[model samples]
Target: MKATVYVTIKQNVLDPQGSAVQGALHSMGFDEVGKVRIGKYLELELNTTDRAEAESRLKAMCEKLLANTVVEDYRFELEG
Candidate 1:
């Protein structure tokens, strides 16, 4: 099984890196761009074939290490 995780800052949280990227884009003449939020994308390969078990473990992984629940949100997808 394959799992993919996306981790991003929460809506109410401040994102300095995102802001810096937005500013750089504007300076590069990409004025049409507005707000930008930076995030993380992770892909994992699992040894288990059980979809339910994989999902359960994935969620736990996110809560325990993948995301900072206080300031970040995470979502994952599973693929066979």
Candidate 2:
């Protein structure tokens, strides 16, 4: 199975990197760009075929390492 994970900053947190990118874009004539937030995408391959176990493991992975629960949120999709 393949797992695709997306990790993003919490809405209440400040995203400096995202802000910088937005600023650069505006300077380059893309002035319509508004609030920007940065995030992380991750892909993982697992040997298991069971959806239940995969979901449990994936949640543990996100909570323990893939995302900082205090400032980030994560969600994932699984495919065979």
The number of the candidate with the highest TM-score is: 1
Clash-forming residue pairs, model 1: none
How far off is model 1, as Cα RMSD?
Answer: 0.5
Full-model lDDT, candidate 1: 0.97
Residues 1-80, candidate 2, lDDT per residue (tens digit)? Answer: 99999999999999999999999999999999999999999999999999999999999999999999999999999998
20, model 1: CA deviation in Å? 0.0
38-72: candidate 1 lDDT, tens digit per residue: 99999999999999999999999999999999999
Error of 2 at 66 (Å): 0.5
* Clash count per candidate: 0, 0
Overlapping backbone residue pairs in candidate 2 total 0
Cα displacement (Å) at residue 61, model 2: 0.5
Local distance difference test values of all predictions, in order: 0.97, 0.97
